[model samples]
Target: MTVTEVLRRFNRTYTQRIGVLEESFLGTGRPLAVSRLLFEIGSAGAVGVRELRELLDLDSGHLSRMLRRLEDDGLVATTVDGADRRRRLVSLTTAGQQAYDDLERRSDERASSLMAPLTPRQQERLADALATADLLVRAATVRLRQVGDDDPVAREATRRYVAELDDRFPAGFDPGPLAPEPDATWVVATSDGRPVAHGGLRPVPGRDDTAEIKRMWVDAGWRGAGLGTRMLRHLESLAREQGYRRVVLDTNGTLTGAIEMYERAGYARIDRYNDNPYAEAFFEKELSSAS
Candidate 1:
């Protein structure tokens, strides 16, 4: 079967196996969504309604309804935030706290039950597979969009990228000479509205059909999840949209992961293309017009 079909099949079975489709989750007498909301609020102590909505990717109206239900049940309390009268804050009530503790205990018991039938080695394999799946799923949900270099999120991402490079490169890295040009296009990848990866494409000096990819970095937490490849592909697409037929990039030799990624993505090693003192390796890729 195709990978997509297999993924769907696994998702169906996994959700069913985990009791996610049941009206009562973990014996909480609440639907899966409500239980999850309670867990989030309980863990956070208190959370702003807007923040909660964003965290859960919930519709404002639907979230309001759920909060109302919880409030009516005396399991949650909502108050106008003291610091921000326009915003509402949600926190667990005494009963809600008790419920949260119960949910946690029951959740652990359910996990133990699931693992009971498996051998120790099989349990370890399952844990490792679940971790991998979680990372890949989170990575897939990250959003990539183009923005100007001066955008706050873009600038923040660039600063973090430079800081990381400085820590990794033996000679230390500097951002003074790496600022993107005025006409450059910058892309940032965000998960839950927080930037996790950033890169840019600028016209190569004296090369009409070539674009230089710059400031490519992925947050350390997100590095091994294929986000770097996704960012590279995005930059290539942007370059093609801007009428460039080739893309080039430079990186420090210390960044072996980046070098390997470039090679895997069909970038060929080339002679030094720029005078950046920090760059030790250069690579280039030809892009199809339709890319």
Candidate 2:
């Protein structure tokens, strides 16, 4: 089968295996949607309605309907936040707690039963695959957008990036010479309005046809999700847009993973591109064409 067909088949099988199409999930007499909501609230003890909606990626009307259904069933209660009257908090009612506990118990049992037929090695591989799938799904949801140099989220992400470099480098690092230039383009990758990765392209000194990719960083938790590759490709595209024919970047030798990624992305090793004291490796890549 083709890749798309394979993915669709997996999706169908996984959903069916998880009882997603069933009218009653975990014998709770409710669909998976509301049961999930109850489970979330129960897990958190209490959660803001806005947070719930964002966490579930549910539209306001759909979330309202779900909340109403749970409320009607006496499984959850909504109360106005004392600190913010405009916001509402959802918490499980006594009956809701009972239902949530039952759901959790049944879900764990179901998972165990499903995995029982698998060999130990197969089970481990399945768990690893599921974890990879979850990370890739999260990576796909991240949004990349250009922002001004002074954007707060971008600044915060840059700060985190620098701190990480200091932690990773053999000697502590300095950020003094890495200031953004007026003509540079900055890109930030965000998930749920929080910046999770950053990269930028700046003009090479006295060079109109070439640009430098700088400050490429991905949040630690987001590292293995291929966000770094996404950010690199994004910066390259931005460089192409700005009329640059080539892009260059430098990294510390301690960043073996980054070095490997750069090589895989077709960045060729080049001579020292700049006088950055911390850089131990440099790379360059020529753009195919600017769209």
**lDDT of model number 1:** 0.90
Q: Which segments of model 2 are wrong by more than 4 Å?
A: 42-54, 71-99, 137-142, 147-156, 174-184, 190-196, 203-208, 219-225, 269-277
| Residue 174, candidate 2: alpha-carbon lDDT | 78
- lDDT of model number 2: 0.89
Candidate 1, residues 58-157, lDDT tens digits: the string is 8999999999999999999999998879989999999999999999998899899989999999999999998988888889998888888887778889
Give me the runs in candidate 1 sitting further than 4 Å from their true place. 45-48, 74-95, 148-156, 174-182, 192-194, 205-208
C-alpha lDDT score of every prediction, in listed order: 0.90, 0.89
Candidate 2 structure quality by residue, lDDT tens digits, 182-265: 888899998755678999889999888999998899998898889999999988888887788999999999999999999999
| Best of the candidates, TM-score | 1
Q: How many clashes (backbone N, Cα, C below 3 Å) per candidate?
A: 0, 0
